[model samples]
Target chain A: MVSKTEETQLNRLENQVDNGGGGAWEYLCLVRKLKVRRSEKVLKHGLSILNDPKKRSALGPEEWTLYEQVAIAAMDCQCLDVAKDCIKVLQKKFPESKRVGRLEGMLLEAKGSWAEAEKAYSSLLEDNPLDQVIQKRRVAMAKAQGNISGAIECLNKYLEIFMADHDAWRELAEIYVSLQMYKQAAFCYEELILSQPTVPLYHLAYADVLYTLGGLENLQTAKKYYASTIDLTGGKNTRALLGICLCTSAIAQLSKGRNKEDKESPELQSLAATALEKDYKQRASDKLGLLTSALRSLKI
Target chain B: MGLGFIIGVFGVLILSHAAYSTIQYRGLLKIMEEEFSGPPMNVVLELLLGFVFCIWAALTVPGKFLSIHPDSEENRIVSLSANLDFMIFNHRAKAFPLEIDMKLKH
Candidate 1:
């Protein structure tokens, strides 16, 4: 049913494949199209060309491009196993290339080789120590494997490499907080605040850790850090919240003093009074209610 | 006599500043205790000043007492203006939240 000209075009394409100049990807594409079109002759020709061992051996840069092409074609054809095998071959051939490793890692991840992907990412990180993408990918891979500790450890390692990376610090802090590792989280938050003295939430985070640690001395530091947050905010709306936190933390620290039955110093009482008066209206209703309860219990 | 007087004046000024810090710290402590219900102002003030005084004394004490020669490296690191590059290296291991708190907007 096909025209002579169409048949000749097919023959020429097959002959092109036979010459081994077009690379693996080119042949894969032709074969895939022929399979879709149900052209048996073209498909047979493509398969024959691709399976040639001599063609595989001659793969240089052009061949690597061909390998990627063939792998992608295999993926497109839903032959994921074939694609993976092709990538493995490429990995062996180009062991030193980051691109090859990354591609292999992606393929492994696609195939659900979570642990292998993590190892590949780890190896990549050794070469590109501050590669944020790899760092994130490594965390994701660890977490996917249900290795929460592993995920945390990987990020901690990343933090060591890129210590000033606030995002890494923040991520570590969040993870610690989630695990109820308050002391460690607080230390991380402190580093964050010291690194970026302007961020108010880092102060809040530090204060949260102090509260969780449950001590008067920690409470005092929390109050001071909150004040620093407020001062840094310079009358921003957030400053009002920070100021309230500062007051509340101060109040908590003050309550600890009552354990000694020491009469409240007048100046200390005045400052608390002033803070209470200033922040009362602005304080969140829930927080204010909690504050009232604390005040009653402490008899402040 | 003139040189001695100048030296005496310098010493007095340093002592006066230290005394002022002490008094201020004590006042803050009293405020903290009465207002927040905490420790004596003097104790709080003393604790706060302890580190400051140590650092101050360490830096200002003449070469005779545990002398540390001033180094350019320390000076370069603590420039008056905020140096972004230096800050990056100094705080490399520390991560601060990039989410700027809306409440902190100046």
Candidate 2:
């Protein structure tokens, strides 16, 4: 529906905003709208506003929130000098603010001073133990220092207090996968699936973990979950199609010497194989010949 | 008969050398166990060095003098012809050269 000229004009406007040609407040709002606080454009516009004395005075007391936002954005963009200037201004205005203290800790984090950042975050937590941002930052500091187990511990504690945080669950799952603890990752995915059962990605991830575990029972469960993923995505997922093929083959291998009644039927294997071949032929463009030949070699 | 005798003698010589090295290794192990009263690491290092020497001797001594080479030009030509025969026997004739007869179907 969007014409080419309109798209070009939109891109030009975005570029202008990105280069700090847009007003500071508009730029901040735009970056916030995009949920991209760490962008270089945010940092540049934030600095321009805070540097000009006239523009600085024009921002009334209520707009002091902009200073904190700008400082954090600057820290995210690795502009420590601009961040420090903003921090000094905020600290002078409100010397006893705990939120300002959190920003100070984040500044230390930006400086690669992990221990000092930890100390700063700990003192802030002691003053106000229920601060979620401080808790998350502590977890982030542990992660940045490559203490994955420590990060996991902190995240578990945070999740105990805030059990519904999907982002925290996803992060814990990722850490478990990095450690090759697939069972624990599956548990995390299970929680995510329980909370949001309709999400295709959670089902896909859980199926992948079960497939990696690879027993007859786990493979059957993985196949069911992968089927659900395929159904949820309307059969567009190549990986789910491949997973179905693999699980069928693995089940066939496992049940080969078992009782005849326990074996997955030949008809089911043939159906999965044919479906996979059709989907691969239809979807796989660059590796069409290779994938088709590979499926053919599977002998299903 | 002379070539067979020479090959038999070389084989016996290699086998005897291998057996002697093995017996010497066992004797060294027994000696270390009974006489050496140093750290365990020294015994381990000695055993490791013995193993390395055994493998090195096995590789270098017997194979170097016993390999039969077919390095004449006639042998090389025979090998090349065999490979050419395999290619010709297995090759399938194409209907046309791939670069020609380009077709577009919609």
Candidate 3:
């Protein structure tokens, strides 16, 4: 039984479709989202409207964007033939469009003709060297081919042009970590922290990298960052609590013979360990026993 | 042929420098061991050997070089488009909806 809210939404959608409103495609997309298995119903409705001679002629130039949306929806529904038909219509309507060219390249990719797809994107880039989407696609292709360095190089070049892209920075940082380039990964996280300082994940990640690098100074910094992470998360982060405990012990060992006293006190390590034990018991009881054993092995 | 020779010379130069550094490190370790009972020489030797092999592998591996075939403007297009296709498909399932949403608003 459809609820009152769902029925109201469906009625609104029907009214929009009946009146030839601009939001018909959006309505169908919403329906597609609600019942994914009923996408064929939405596609058929869209196709019927497109097929009607009067309706086709009545649609404005901007409304023609619906064809691409319908094509993508058809693709999602595994109706390749329908998608191809829509793409053909779109191509005929906008023959010289780079946007259409991108869709064509996407179709080639979907068809598993990677080399041909690459050629299409390359030509598109040749026409406009600063095309950001095409540039990102090039990096994605290198990654798909398992060319890590190539992907890194492409991302580096793209960042040179668009340095403010945080998503790209995060991706580059992850790739650096995968390559075990902790210093480089640290630099990326530093960029992220500088841009958005309050995000606990960046602090946690930066701390992890510094800990892995393992110098007295780096470990000290790592401990500080982990503390910041815990504070930011309101002391609810088990990993950050564990990090404080581990860093305390490690720093104590590293500074044993050195002039510098241990920055992390034994009392602090005990307190963090106690908090971690209680939190793990509350959240992950099964891991609680293992955590105790691990702490024992560490002699913390 | 010229590129190969240059690569070969570069590899040799790097290997010689690495070897020189390893010998100097070993001597320093030996002196430290005599004065202060430093770490085991065998462990230090193994680490140095591993570092040298890593550098050698990186230098000699010609596969690291970009090997795009039929190197021409057309082929460059092929490579670039292939890259773009990769990016598109990779983010399609997740990011396409966001793209469409932005398009609809515009």
Using DockQ, give the best candidate's number: 3
Q: Could you tell me which residue pairs clash in candidate 2?
A: none
Q: lDDT for every model? A: 0.55, 0.66, 0.69
Q: Which has the higher DockQ value, candidate number 1 or candidate number 3?
A: 3
For residues A90-205, could you state the per-residue lDDT of candidate 3 as single tens digits? 88888999988877776676565779979999999999999887777777667766789999999998988898877678878988999999999999999988986756777888
Q: Candidate 1 on B55-104: residue-level lDDT in tens?
A: 55554554344313221222111111111111111121113322211110
User: What docking grade does candidate 1 earn?
Assistant: incorrect
**Candidate 2 per-residue C-alpha lDDT over A82-153 given as tens digits, one digit per residue, 9 for 90 to 100:** 678778888888998998898898889877787898898888888889887788777777777778899999
Residue A244's C-alpha lDDT in candidate 2? 83
Clashing pairs in 3: A117-B81, A118-B81, A118-B82, A119-B78, A121-B81, A122-B81, A137-B83, A137-B84
Q: Which stretches of candidate 1 lie over 4 Å from their true place?
A: A1-116, A119-132, A235-299, B1-106
The deviation in Å at residue A132 for candidate 2 is 1.4
- True lDDT of residue A7, candidate 3: 48
Cα deviation in Å at residue A153, candidate 1? 2.1
- Chain A vs. true chain A, TM-score per model, equals 0.49, 0.74, 0.69
What is candidate 1's lDDT per residue for A79-135, written digit by digit as tens? 455556667777788878887776666566645667787788888988887777666
Worst 10 residues of 3 chain B by lDDT: B75-84
Q: All models, DockQ values?
A: 0.01, 0.00, 0.03
